[model samples]
Target: MRTGGKRTASVFLLLTVLLLLLFYCNLALGTRFFSPAKLFSLLSQGRGNDPAVSILFKIRLPRALMALFLGGALAVSGFLLQTYFANPIAGPFVLGVSSGARLAVALCMMLFMAQNRALSSFALVFAAFLGSLVSLGILLAVSQRVRQMAGLLVAGIMIGYICSAATDFLLSFAADSEIVSLHSWSQGSFSGMSLAQVRTAAVLIGISAFALLFLAKPLAAVQLGESYAESLGVNVRRMRSALIILASLLAATVTAFAGPVSFVGVASPFLIQSLLKSNKPLLVLPASFLGGAVFCLASDLIARTAFQPTELALSTVTSFFGAPIVLWLLVKRRGK
Candidate 1:
């Protein structure tokens, strides 16, 4: 057992190193050519008449930072939801939270654009929060009477469909320009992230991530079964509520900043679990965050550079990788 534990720790450390390297590489490579040598020199020299330095500092940094926080937030949310629901396939989107966020964002964008009013970033964030909470409330109500995980999942999907229908109805009545904006927002992109937005996301995601870390032990206990957790002196109800709130906040913030970049919340935790060969939240949670950051950064790189001069949607890149993995996991579990 000790040997196995040591191996797991080593693998996690190696992956963490690789993730950090990829992050720096993302910083180095972009549309503009900033050679590694020049980038290093510019950083060391403080302020210089270097256009590359300015671009890196102003443009690339924010986008890369946004990817990091958004990825971490999605992965952490995935981990919490999976553990709480005891379903490997469970995710933030599974509970209709992302759909709720989409609805709120759609309504806000349509109303603001139609009124010719400038929409503040805060308004967008608040809209996402409100939408996610509405879905969460419905899910919680259903869960109270439905003891089966499968039943809860169905409730979530039904809620998602309802929200989607409502969003489509609103879009039909919206102005052409508003519809265009909504379509773009739904596709999900990390581009055009300002430093201020990145900073805000980072702070919110950071705090939420820390909260998850602190609850890791309790979460693992709850995974054994709520009654078992209670026997161990764990407040199952409080922990469950905290997990929902944390996951909702994490998902809402990421959707608000990065748009509804799907599958990260469904895929990242599973990837980390496979890598570590363990479901202990203490191990899975942090590893999922790092894995998520790596996955998103790599996906963004492909989205930007895959088809020269033509950027792809972030969702498209992620889905190409995420869909196959999810199918494989489903088949493998079914065969067992």
Candidate 2:
């Protein structure tokens, strides 16, 4: 195999191994540890009256699967945004898309709670999707006037700040009861995930990923330049719109389920691209998905276990690893 191809294969193999290992770790090692053989035996019995079975099926399994799917969704969303913006660091979180979704979900939850009604999974997803669109809309408007990519990034950061501040303000007026519920979600976590919710997220992310795979050719073309893409018969406007919607959908689905995860989006794609030594969309897209799953599983494992009974928020672990990667990318790009 060619050097780049060999590198790609090696990296992908490594990511897959890590993903499986971490998936096992997330399930087998928790407040109560389960050995691999025991976990397998529990699974074979199917839902039973045993407490260990309940923990395995109802809790650990669902949480692990959610992290696997949602983590991939976040990374794919980030990859799509980076392609659209032609900026390596561009991602849903950095661009305020996730924040927008978070704000919407928070608002929806608060309203539903006030009415003494609970939001269905689908309703939360819809609300998050709407918020993501709104954030992207604002970012697009800023892009129109801000000629420089750096300026547009700065604007995105400001928009994120504004949305976050709005969320906090809303929280201040919320009931203590509401605060207790929202506080846990707002901090970001994979805890409390259910099998039904996992199905919802998996279906949504599955569809988005399917669409993304088909868009790879045009995405690569657009990455080179709009003019080149146009020459290749790619409708730049339609492609741009599709990219925005897909990115938003992926980000929204994740936020709807896991609150707002940090850094997986930005860090995963960069690491994947660097490892593969290529920017080819088809190659990077799937690899980024796997890389993201591994990253999140590792981070989540650390977050829960690092403090024993006291668990850290998901973002706390992600930012700890993700921030330095972002900083390195910034400094490396600035020199070029």
Highest lDDT scorer: 2
Candidate 2 displacement at residue 259 in angstroms? 0.9
lDDT tens digits, residues 205-286, model 2? 9899889878999989998899999999999999999999999999999999899998899999999998888889999999
Cα lDDT of all candidates, in order? 0.83, 0.92
- Per-residue lDDT of 121 in model 2: 94
**Residue 156 of candidate 1: its Cα lDDT?**
90
Tens digit per residue, CA lDDT, model 1, 190-290: 88888898878877887887787679888888888889989999998899889888988888888887777778888888988887889888788778888
TM-score of each: 0.91, 0.98
Query: Candidate 2: which pairs clash?
Result: none
Clashes of each: 0, 0
